[model samples]
Target chain A: MKLTVLYFAWVRERIGLPRETIETDAATVADLVEELRGREPRYELAFADLSALRVAVDQELADFDAPVRDVTEIAFFPPMTGG
Target chain B: MAVRVQQEDFDFGAEADAFAEGRADAGAVVTFTGLVRDRPDGGLREMEIEHYPAMTERAIAAIEAEAVSRWNLVDSLILHRYGRLRPGARIMMVATAAPHRADAFAAAEFLMDYLKSRAPFWKKEVTDAGAEWVAAQAEDEAALGRW
Candidate 1:
């Protein structure tokens, strides 16, 4: 599946890229993250601690275990604190 | 119930007037406007807000719905602005009207609390020294847990 991944805040800084398009065979969000972590050192550093990061699949808040099939976009960022 | 996520600033008076117009049952109206502070603890200069297009609106709508369910509110309006915002600029507003002040105040506060902790918007501040990303406060998450 083809997915557009977005990184925000400190996650974007650690990853060095704000967004990207990737083609992966990963079944879930966690699996896709692992694939990215293996591709480069930056990905590993950015995703070092999943607890500090939040994920959204197709613009809805989601967990790492969520399925990624048919999802066109996935965003990763620190937890939100806006009013 | 009205929820508006816009890039333009809004007038509280006009919005409140519109919300309570022709509604005699709305005896009390509570409005809360959040503005950008000139200084943060970290010496921040400016705030840059970014939001998910579809998700932000949905989240706000859910928050408004929850507030409506919890209170006997006559009408509610939530307006939030996005993109770059300067110090003293209006960031958001939440207005709740009901037959009494207690319900209006409670509902307005509830909406603000939910928006603060639950909304899916990211903020980055540019200071004279450097740029830093804001983190979600544990207290905010705890506040949501109460409801």
Candidate 2:
């Protein structure tokens, strides 16, 4: 499966890219994270602390254990500071 | 319901007035404006707000829909700004209208409570010394439980 992954704020800063396209057979969001972490040190650093991060699969807030089989988009970012 | 996310500054008074204009069904309207506060130490330079564009709109609209349904609001508006903002600039505004004051006020509060953490916006504080992303407060998340 092909997925477009996005990063925002410090997550983008740490990952050194705002977005990327990856091909993976990962079934869950956590599996995808693991695949990315195995790619390079930058991804490992950005994903080092899952507690500090949030994920959105297909533009909806999703859990780490959420399935991503048909998901086209995934975004990772720090917890929002809005309003 | 209306949700606007932009980099341009908006006229709060004008927007609020327009939202309430000639609405016979609504007797009470409440508006809340959020502004970037200047640091007490006077060391802050600007606020850099970054957001996931598509998700920001979707998330805000979803929350607005929830507020309208929960409170039976007559109307609602959410306008948020992104990108670089100077201290004292209007960062965002939320307005809610209902037949009664209680519904109007509560709906506005609910919109605010959710917007603080649910929306995809992230704020970065820039100062003379350096710049840092503002971490989301735990209290903000806990505030959602009140709903």
Candidate 2 regions with alpha-carbon error over 4 angstroms: none
Best by TM-score: 2
**Alpha-carbon shift of residue B8 in model 1 (angstroms):** 2.0
Docking class of 2: high
TM-score of each: 0.91, 0.99
What's the TM-score, to 2 decimals, of chain B in model 2?
Answer: 0.98
Which candidate ranks first by DockQ, i.e. highest?
Answer: 2
Q: What shift in Å separates residue B124 of candidate 1 from its native position after superposition?
A: 1.7
Tens-digit per-residue lDDT, B20-98, candidate 1: 7898998898989998876736476688888777688888998898888989998998898888888888999988999
Tell me what TM-score chain A of model 2 achieves: 0.98
Most accurate candidate by lDDT: 2
Q: Candidate 1: which docking quality band?
A: medium
User: Each model's DockQ?
Assistant: 0.74, 0.93
